[model samples]
Target: MSSSPIATVKRELLVRHLEAWAPAALHRARRVIYAHGYADADGGVSAEAAMRVLAEQSDLVRGRELIMVATGDDLGAIDPRLKTISAESGAGAGLAVHTISGGTDGRLPVGLKAVGAQRVPVLGFLDASGSEPPAPATVAALTAGKPSEMLLVLPPGSSASSVDAYRAGWPLFTQVELADSEEPGELLVYATTAGKSLEGFKEALWSVDEFAGVRYRDPGDPERHLIDISLTPHPGPLRRELLAHLAQAGEATVTELRTFALTETVYRAADATRVLHTLVDAGTVTRRPSHGRLGGDVVISA
Candidate 1:
């Protein structure tokens, strides 16, 4: 399967945003290395040409550091060459590899052994005809800023529940939405995990919770639970109802909705209040004094 054109567009927008923000965040680095790789070739525009296109669009890559290019007819089979080019680029190099995978082509070879040594984090694009590649678990692990290690594998035809279990073990990884042709229209959760892969990691993900929800586990201390939440696309119905009730009622004491909303959802009144407060902060709702009640009225609106 491949990614939809819309998904590709969205991912491009996201990449642009990230590129704009990278410099500010990495002000201390002397230069940002931009390493480019391609999975295939197309009419006139060779992989080198594509690299130039990326370099042109990315302000960070404009004469700031070295630009390394690697291309092959098949990316999965040429993992070692990709690593070598990445290593030659320099240490602490920021990589941007573009692989042309249509999805379901088996995992594109992305090993951390070489890139990890450089301590360089990479942003990648797997271009195809459908949706963008889901965020890789390796990226999620890197975000933890911890030295721990773990390997996350998406076995062939693995269920959503299996992915969720892997996520539960690594709480530090944030979820990103991914749409790819391999699963067309199916939502996938992307999280950062350790750069290192441990043997049997894939089996462990399958052995755990059978539910289709994300979980966080710390590699250093596997006993600690970070977060465990469902990866369902739609927001919970109870959450929506509570917001609607708050909108209609203007403002009701937290106690008033405990039985119907809070208790039913297994959320404490404090949590409910926090949600409402966040809404208020975002200007989606407003808080005011209650004229006759013990608590205040929360006016929910756009």
Candidate 2:
């Protein structure tokens, strides 16, 4: 698709402003930390994803440090023990941690506390779902006696009016827009920082190639940085197609199946084989008993 002229102008403006703004923003805090309240259900965001975002931001705020604290339902759902391990690791890494229950007012659950001891002034809140940005009192408490930056990361279809309410009050903050398009999803990040070259910053945003698409907007009177990109599919469609094909076949030698099903639309034999094995291990499919060739009579059956 052709790029829109407005998008081009916006991109140019964004790079220019961030180059001038990021340095000043980082002047007070030597390190910036990011934390997510929830994962995108369509293609869940994890610490790995957060790290990618932070890495891009790090390039923008050259001298400053970056830390991450990821919270939400998926962590517990994917692996509770792993979640505990990650939290402990965060503390060891000197990162403040908090757990967020999705659909709440963007506040941490009752017993959770915002990370304070690290002297982190700016707290990036990812995936807020409620009507308000956050209570001023809550903001006061979170940033208490410290210079801080608060950015909101929200999904598409979020209430713009609610976001506007917060923007009206906090002009320095930026909003990063994320939309679930395709598999991996894309995020449009808009923010203003001091002493950073907007061009360099915009380039940094594009470094997240794992995402299918990305875009940036400049910081100005209506300072903006917008990123529009699609998410790379995980486990991809080809793998799924291979599994389905195998299920339909009832049972067949790997070589026989590969000859009939392998194509640009399907996974490579190696990947398909791996996926099949995974399904078998998960009990979603059964592997026939065979002690011969790696490409033996491997029957895929439910």
Candidate 3:
């Protein structure tokens, strides 16, 4: 069966993130564990994307590995395709693919353990399509004191409590509600400890081309504004968030505010800088080093 438009957008975003993350991850980690929960029969949409990343970064994979594990009730259809990819990618020696035919919630943990992922860096994409969300503990265990991250897809209109439960163990998280031509929409939660990972995720998020009939909503927005998916994203949301942050902080340096945007908000550091400049021109905020261009040391107060 073909995927719906929304599914296509989701998959595109997933591919973009994997492409952006894999290169940096391969540099320090011994293995890249990609665990897919509720995996599609054909190894999910991003498997090829992962292979492409591995192929492109072949030089970086001196002795490192990319282990792709797909878990579902019946993943028989994906095994051969994974083998083909492993062989064709020209990196077979560093590629390992496994298919576990069983419930994802149960099989994912076992699959991850079986592949010896406990000590390595793992990037897990857990989709709760036909099964309940994996226990929060399971997701947390993957990241506890380790250089691991998880991307979660929760059902439309999933309660805020459930979101909180999933975010408990991670020091940082970024969540966006993806709304399409439907009543309610899916929620994507990306949890990680490293600020660099969040930055890469935002880069991946904006890297995708705008798809028709799809919009992204930030749940934290009081107005619940929906943003269009575009290469040059709208900065209105970032403007508001920056002002609010300044209000809370009273005063901060340009460098500090940029860091806030990169880590705490969906906007990039450059986006934050531009918005702050506009605010300065409009007399909305005052800067101490007002004579020259706004450098990192310039202090700004609301």
Candidate 4:
């Protein structure tokens, strides 16, 4: 099936995350559950891509159990494709794939239980279409404890309250807007309580290959700036955010600032240092112990 470039990018984002998160999660949780909403309808690209990763990198998944629960109205097309992928990849005996033919509302929860999700870590990719997103209860179920994470693709103009409701219990939550040419596109929401999982996601977000005529928008940015998905993305948004954070705190250590960037903002912790050094060079902000390299111990004031 032919997929639009932007749609393909979204799938790649999920695959890239699984590539990074699955290995670490297997080591930490002993088992992994991947629940896909709208699996067959979207051609099962993400599930297929993710399963291929497990197949190709057998060493990382040797002992750990990986269960993939794919939910869709019908699996007539995707089921065969998935079977072929598993067969060709020669995925290990430990890997299990379940195709639930029903609405995600009822079947997703059932699939989760059938796989012992409560006892293991789960990575749910709720690829919601149009205005309707996965229910708040569905999202809450995924955030039951640490190491369980959820990713949602919400339509444009989705309510802030809907997102807030989805983010309710998670200690860490972040979203990136997929731009559609000139206008803002769908929103990709990620919620989790695990710091390591969140860190892995952030790495995946910036590392995915750049798509033409598309850029990711920092939803937190007031101007709704569209930025490229690159290692050294423009730090304009971080610059403003740091100034506001410094204004409120009066002064903060480099470590504190870096943590703020990591936890509270879309920018990575490494971006914090680069923006700070630029600010200091411009004389917009001052750093104590300015005579030496910008270490974590150095303090910054606006």
Per-model TM-score versus the true fold? 0.37, 0.39, 0.86, 0.90
lDDT leaderboard ranking: 4, 3, 2, 1
lDDT of 4 by residue, 1-302 (tens): 42876777888888888777677777877678888887765667776776676656556556777778888778777887776666675556667678888767778887788778885778888878543677788777776434688888888877678778887778888888888665768888887878777777888888888777778877777777778889898898888889989999999999999888887777788999999999999999998987799999999998
lDDT of 2 by residue, 261-284 (tens): 332221234445666666666777
Q: Judging by TM-score, tell me the better candidate of 1 and 3.
A: 3
lDDT at residue 205 of model 1 (Cα atoms): 27
Lowest-sum lDDT 10-residue window in model 1: 195-204
Winner on lDDT (1 vs 2): 2
Output the number of the TM-score-best candidate.
4
Tens digit of per-residue lDDT, candidate 1, span 163-232: 5554543442322222222232223233333322211122232233323333332111212222333222
- Using lDDT as the measure, the top candidate is 4
Q: Candidate 2 vs candidate 3: which has greater TM-score?
A: 3
Query: What are the lDDT figures for the candidates, one per model?
Result: 0.36, 0.40, 0.76, 0.79
